[model samples]
Target: MADDFTPRYGEVEQMAPGIRRVLARNAGAFTYYGTGTYIVGNGAVAVIDPGPDDADHVHAIRAALEGERVSHILVTHTHYDHSPAAVPLKAATGAEIVGCAPLVLDDNGPRADAGFDRDYSPDRVLTDGDVVAGSDWTIEAVATPGHTSNHLCFAYREGEALFTGDHVMGWSTTVVSPPDGDMADYMRSLEKLLERDERIYYPTHGAPVDNPRRLVRGMLTHRKQREYQIVALLKEGVKHIPDMVARMYVGLDPRLTGGAGRSVLAHLVDLKERGQVRETDGEWRLCATSARD
Candidate 1:
């Protein structure tokens, strides 16, 4: 897989006059541009979503530093590809890592992909309103947890440019992977961004978006359309995530089908929570409506 995998390398681009975005090139299951790293202010740079554990990628980042002080490494989430490299990068640059608190363990157990290394733990946990300052620039933390519970998006308050991790992208819709990824939370997070007036969004993967609110609305509409399609499928006798995925994502990539199932399951969970559907004994069905039997 590694050999076949075309590493989507990253290049540095300016998001604002002082903010530089490093777009990664790894564009597959393992790494979507790896992670979009940002350098803010001169000599006081901040790296967002440190990306995968690729030595070359890390080296590229170190190269990009080019004598500028790397002051902070901010993680949008703790997925292996995005956060694991933060530790080594921190070691190399002596930058303080920042992110959300760990997940809450239930009686069932810690959620899938929850616990992260304390070594990679952020020097400071970023809350909804915390600010990371560069030379003269400031990146405000926005708690946009959807792709993962710990997900955070950093916004440059000056130009209203947002560093959107997996929450939003220019090339593709993000995978709402479960255990940590929730459709309801994701929808809310989308709405959160929609309500904002950000002009540009630099995502962890792919190119930057110019009109983020429009893109957010488009994503929201797509989700709603998918939800309705799933509901209709259930009404017509499709009874589980696998079935809905098979029917809805016909002729799609087999590998991506699993991720599709995760999104479908998230929709099902949201529908059930909304009293629009119900699941029992591994089967799913629509709730009784006034117009339907």
Candidate 2:
């Protein structure tokens, strides 16, 4: 699907009945157009993922909420672009910060960027199935810890739409960087979403996913293909992440090789845990059982 949605920073665009999006000015390789800060409902509202800590972005959120009371500042995760502005938003509106706890890192995982908001502490920690109610909106928390260990996707009951965060995006497949992200958990989370009946999804970085199930299935299939490719490469004597990425990602952009390597490492770690592969001195090899099965 073509991404035709162009975000206008510092301006409010009503996406649906009560949901408004204010795009931040910060845009980059990871963040598609920009960080989408969603305001759910009027009068008494809930601001989700208050973008970065840019003063202009914070002022824009406050301006968007003019004449309205912010009851909750919801965070999907603590990624720098996703949750840093919660502090300023909370201070400006006196809204309670609600979402997952701080990120938990795995020391043995691959070297990846840990750009998290270290100082962020949610006023209320929401577990799976917890609900945050507003006057016109009621958001049910769905714990999806794959993109990050503390990530949460909120389901807006009124619209039957899910705020998917980075777990599932419309424009691109989510990057699962291990240490903070787990491939097994990420796949399990995708399976978890299949059991729900949400028709639409509002992701943090791109256009709304109209066909939630189709997008999720595509994502799962893509991951499975990558895993299979990795296994095939291991069978061919490719024993390291850099070699696997080189063989798997043909004509990949030079700038993205680092991220691709990290993703390959995440898959390797998951495969090791599943007993399909084994690692010796950081070199990976397919197991005999994997070859037979």
Judging by TM-score against the true structure, name the best candidate: 2
User: How good is model 2 by TM-score?
Assistant: 0.95
In order, what lDDT does every prediction score? 0.76, 0.87
Q: Write the per-residue lDDT of candidate 2 for residues 260-292, one digit (tens) a residue.
A: 887788888899898889999989998998977
lDDT by residue for model 1 (96-175), tens: 98866655323121223333433456789999989888766788999988777888998888767888877898777887
Give the Å shift of residue 114 in candidate 1. Answer: 11
RMSD of each: 4.0, 2.1
TM-score of each: 0.87, 0.95
The C-alpha local distance difference test score for the whole of candidate 1 amounts to: 0.76
Candidate 1 lDDT score at position 181 = 77
- Candidate 1 has a TM-score of 0.87
Show model 2 residue runs off by greater than 4 Å. Answer: 1-5, 104-114
Where is model 1 more than 4 Å wrong at Cα? 1-16, 23-25, 30-33, 103-119, 290-293
